[model samples]
Target chain A: MGNQKLYKGSLQTIILKLLAQNDKMYGYEITQHVKELTKGELKITEGALYPALHKLEAEGLLDVEVAKVGNRLRKYYKLTENGTKETANKLAEMQEFLKTMQHLVNPKFSLE
Target chain B: MELTKEQVLQIDNYISACGIKYYDVKMEIVDHFASILELRLEEEPDLDFKKAIVEEHKKFSNNGFKKLLEIKTDSVHKRFFKSSLKHLFSFFTLPKVIITIAIFLGLQFIMNSISDTEIFFNILQGFALLLSFRLLFNVNMRNNNKISFLSLSITLRFFNVFHLFTILFQFLDNINGEGFNNIHLLAYMVLFLFYWSGEYVYYQNKKEVQEQYPNVIV
Candidate 1:
C-alpha cells in the first residue's frame, strides 16, 4: 500500500501496460490481477480502479465490450491503438520522473 | 433462504435511484445481489443475512459506480452541445446573414431607381412584412428552451397582428408624402428593444433561481 501510494501518478501507465498485454479485462479481474502481482502488498481498491477505467474509455484510449457471463453481465475494457502509443510514452515519462526524484532524494556524496 | 418481498423491492428502488431505469435491468441487478447474499447465508446459516448483504455491497463502492455513470453522461452532454451548436449555426450561418444584407441592398437600390409613390409604398410594405417575421423568429430563437414555445409564439403572433395596423398607418402616411421616418419603424424597433431587455431580465432571474434552489432540477 505504501509503494502503491508512491506509484499514484503511474496508475494509468500501469493500467495501460496491463491492457496492452491482454485482450480485455473486467473491473474485478483487473483489481484481482493487481493484488496477485503485488503479492497482496498492494490492493487496488475498486473505488479507485473503476473510475480510471471509465475515464480512459471516455477519452477514447480504451474500448469496452459487455458480455453476459453466467447470470451476470460484465463490462470488459481493452486498450485502443492510441492507448498503446500513449502507454509507451507515459511509461517513459514516469521512468524519467522517477529517476529525477531519486537523484533529489539521495544526493551523491562529493569525493573530497 | 428466501428474501422477503420487501427486501427485493428495496433493492429495486436503490438500483433505480442510481439511474438504472429499465425495470428488467434493475431486477437483474437486484437478483444478482440477492443471490450473492443467499450464497453467503449458505456458508454460515446463522450469519445475519442483512449484515452479510450490506458487507457484500460495501465491496462495490457507490462513488465508483457513480463516476462510471458520469462518463456516459458526460459523453451524452458533449454530443448535446455539439448538436445545439450545429442547429444554431444553421439558423444564423454567415451565408444567411450575407443573403439578408444583399436583400436590404437590393431594396435600397429599387427605392433609388423608382421614385414612384405606389412602388415606394409597395417596398415599404414589403419591409414591414419582413420586419414582422424577423422580429418574431428572432425572439423565438433567442428564447430557446428558456420560455415555453406556445406562449412565445402567441405573444409574437399578437405582435404580428397588431403590427399590420402600424404598417397600414405608415402606408397612409407614405401616400400623404410623409416619407419613411424612424417613427414609422417604431414597431420593429420596440420589439427588438423588448427582446434585449427580456433577455437581460431572463438571465438575471435564471441566476437568482439557480442560486435559490441549487438542488432543484430544471
Candidate 2:
C-alpha cells in the first residue's frame, strides 16, 4: 500500500497500465477497479481520476469514446498506439523506482 | 439498482446546476453520478436518492464540479493545439509536401504574371470573405440545430475563420499601393497555403466528429 504522496506521482502510470490490460473503461469503473485491486487500501478520488484521464487524452496517449449507456452518455477511454508503447516505458520506469526504493529501505537487498 | 428516468433527469439537473454546461462534459459527469448513485443505493437501500446524489457529489472535492470543468477545458485546448500543429506540419511531409510546393509555385507564378495587382488582391479578399461567411454560416446552422457542443476542433475552426478575416483586412491595409515584390509574393503564397490547410483540418475534424457521434445533430 502506498501513501497519497507516492500514489499521486504514479497515478498516470497506474492508469496507463490498467488501460493496457482493459480494452476500455469509464471514470467510475476506473475508481472502483483501483479500489478493488488494492483491497480498499487505495481509493482514487474522482477529483484525481478525471483530471488524469483528461491529461492523458490531451497528450494523445489515450483516446475517448462516448457511448449511450442506459440513458446517460458514458465516456470510455482506451489507450492509443502511442499509449501502448508508453505503457511499456512507464512500467519499466516504475520497476526501476521500486527497485531503488527497496535498495534504500532494505539494506540487505542487492542490485543483482 | 438501475436508475429511473426521473433519477437520471435529476442527475442531469444536478450537473447542469453545478455549472457543467458543455454537453460532452455534462454527459461524462452525469454518467459518473449515475454509477455512483446506483452503487450507493445498492449498498444502502434505505438511503434517499437526493441524499445519495449529494454524498456522491461531495467526493469531487471542495470545489465540486468546477475543477472538473476547468480541467476538461484545459485538456481540450491542449488537444486542439496539438492536433492543429500536426495538421499544419503535415503540409511539409511526404506526398503532401509535393502538393504544397506545387501550390506555392503556382500561386507565385500567377501573382508575378498578373499586371493588375489590385485585381489579384480583390480576388484573394473575396475568397477570404467567402470562406469566413461559409464558416460563420456552418457555425450558425450547428447552433440553430441545438448542437451547441463546440468541441475543441470545432472551436479552432471558428477561431481560424475569424482569424482569416482579420488577416484579410490587414493584408489589404498593408499591401495597398505597394509593388508586389518577391517577398510579398512569398508571403501571400504562405498565407494561401495556411488558409487551405486550416480548411482541410476543419473538414477532417468535422467529418470525424460526425462519424464518432452519429446521433449528434451537427
- Candidate with the greatest DockQ versus the true structure: 2
Clashes of each: 0, 0
CA lDDT, candidate 2, residue A64:
86
- Give the CAPRI rating of model 2: medium
- Which ranges in model 1 have alpha carbons more than 4 Å from their true place? A108-112, B1-14, B17-50, B62-68, B79-218
lDDT of 2 by residue, A16-107 (tens): 99999999999899998999999988988888889889889889899988887876677899999999999999999989998888899996
Task: Supply DockQ values for each candidate.
Answer: 0.17, 0.64
The most accurate candidate by TM-score is: 2
lDDT of 1: 0.57
The CAPRI classification for model 1 reads as: incorrect
Residue-level lDDT of model 1, residues A68-112, one tens digit each, is 454344457788999888988988887788777777776573212
Error of 2 at A25 (Å): 2.0
